[model samples]
Target: MNGTNKGGAAPGRGGGLASPRFAAVMASQALSLLGMEILQFVLPLHLLNLTGSGALYGGVIAAGFVPYTLLAPIGGVIADRTRKRGVMIAVDAVLAIAMAAYLFAAGTSAVIAATVAVLMLAFAAQALYQPCVQSAIPHLVESHEVERAVALVNQVGMLTGIGGPVAGGIAFGFLGLAPIVFISAACFAASALVVAALVHVPYEPPARTAGAVATARADLKEALAFLRSRPLMWRTIMAATLVNLFGSSFFNVCSPYIVTETLGLPNQLMGVLQGALAVGGLAGGAIVAAVPGTLGIRRVPALLLGVVAGIAAIACVLMVPLPALGTYTALVILYLPTMAVCMCMSIVATSYLQVESPGTLVGKVMALAIMLANCVTPAGQLAYGVALDIVPAWAIALVAASVTAAVAWWLARAER
Candidate 1:
């Protein structure tokens, strides 16, 4: 039901994402993502390089997520109430300004605190902004087109994952970090203008008199009630949350540990492993997009749980000292399947979540699901670190895998 055309762009003539608005937004996404990824790549590396303390760097990085998790639900509520196009435009503009602020903090400690604050705000803006874009997809296309649409949307990110970092690295190597930041700023600003001129879809705006806090609260309550009514979807969300909490935690804390401490490998190898996962994610998103209707709601939990199991297997293999296979080989063998499985899980699961709900509730529901799923990530990462000191890395992985398996099994049974 391609609804109303508010701003510009003709309605897509066919069900195959024929809307010019979709193309416009996708173009905006590409530019915006290219900017964001460069900054995301450059920032942590800069921090790590400057501090030379992983603890300090990780702590600073973790701190940014605090606002993201808390503000994401509010963002969802706003998306439901306002035109998503405007929300995206505003967020992008502000992010561009934030990047400019970081430029001031680029060389010296003069406004180090300000730079960090700006970075935190930028991260929060991103977390908030994502729900709006995701919620906008169904409004732009017919119901049957959602899977392909979401997959196509996801491809923007996948493409950025491949291009952004490499370009960021090249920029950093040749022109330095400041130039990359400047380019990022320009990208967001350009994206704002593109989206402002193009996206057109009608959504019900909430009452202006109600304060944002109250509106957000009401929106979240409604989303929770919807979750209460849908058993399978709720289970998928919860299972996904548990996996996000521990699975990412393991990687954030334990993967490096496995690579550096346990595997006794160089630091560069870690980058290789991360690149592998990014490539794997790109491959997975393309697969989902190409296969159109494969993402049934009931099938999602199994796929996710299977991914978790793959992580467990990868963890177990890392513990072993293979005779002929080198560290790189073992990493390739263990990492590929786990990353690929998770990639498939993410492609199927998130697309299902975004398009399955009613448009009115989609934004808030998407935000709440993403926030709840990700809220514990930082703390879980810290906990994994602490746990590693008390227990061993291999021991921790075994427990994590078992817990993940149990959750997956429970989800599977619930779905049946």
Candidate 2:
């Protein structure tokens, strides 16, 4: 069955990103993820405006991460034990249903609660769905083409980042969240159908020698043991955790605060600023796809140095006397190179991990790595949220740049 049409074509036999099977996977992911990106952009801003509390905004956003972090490992276990296509289809369907219900409940007293709940469901689904897609990459393309395949998949997400935020901002500004919710539901439904009709992955029935919980425990133990043997795994995990803490968390909490509250900019501008990061990511993916041979894991530290500069520039611009629009423009411009470097480093490290891991354990191993790296993200978001209330945004940015510089220095030494 693994070699038959029932699953995807045999591993290493399919063409690179041009293969029809891999193309279907990309299309399916694109549909669902675009809807997700729109909602992710709109929901937090909507809540922030509604409540006018940065701390509350950060808390709600951070809450979604609870399920995301907890379910990631389980998602990996399920990815290994189940049909990958089925998992994708099911998760998309569930997301569609959840969003549809939220569509009906908008503007009601419960809308806020509904917003939080729907967001949690979306995050949880993403946790489960991503491992399936990530682990499926090696099986869908030639061994030599794995890095490009990874870049292509990443590019799909980045494309959505651009389109989703802009669309969401315009829609939320003019038409409001109801139409956006309706569109999101439709996208998820379409994604589920697409995956059902086209995408395929090699599947083998797991030998049921133990109960589900025991099997998951055993699988996690095995993954941990494998990770322990690879020092690269720990290094990558630590580096990623530091970036999430000092770099990404700061951006997430501060970006909306500065745009909507400090500058009093409209939702449309917020969308554009958010889309800048996506543009950077898309560009980075293009670079990786074009020149996979040059960027290696050892270069990850050097990339973070670019991020440090970006953050430092952001901090400096905030303190200078400038018009709100001028500051906004500067912030958007700085995010491009910062996020571009971040994405490149991420793709290189992930591709390296995928090539090194055994196929049987790839899903769990990747999930474990994701879980460990992201576990601190919620705390960072919360802390930044509080810091924004207590300290100036410029002060926070300066601190973030310094911490990132330290992490980059440590990563460079470790690589040497």
Alpha-carbon lDDT, every model:
0.70, 0.86
Inter-residue clash pairs, candidate 2: none
Clashes (N, CA, C under 3 Å) per candidate: 2, 0
Give the TM-score of each candidate: 0.84, 0.96
Query: Considering every candidate listed, which one attains the maximal TM-score?
Result: 2
TM-score of 2: 0.96
Residues 1-416 of candidate 2: C-alpha lDDT, one tens digit per residue = 01121233345565777888899999999999998998788888898888778787777778778788899999989988999999999999998888888877768888778888988899999999999999888788877788888899999999999999988888899998889888988999999999999998867787879999999999989888988898867888888988887789888888988899888899899999989999999999999999985898778888888889999999999988899999999999999988898889889888877777777788888899888888988988888888778888999999899999999899888867
User: What CA RMSD would candidate 1 show?
Assistant: 4.4
Give the alpha carbon lDDT tens digit for every residue of 43-159 in model 1: 765665565444544455566667888888888887788788888899899989888888777777754465457657877888777888787776777666777787778777867
lDDT of 1 at 120: 75
Off by over 4 Å in 2: 1-11
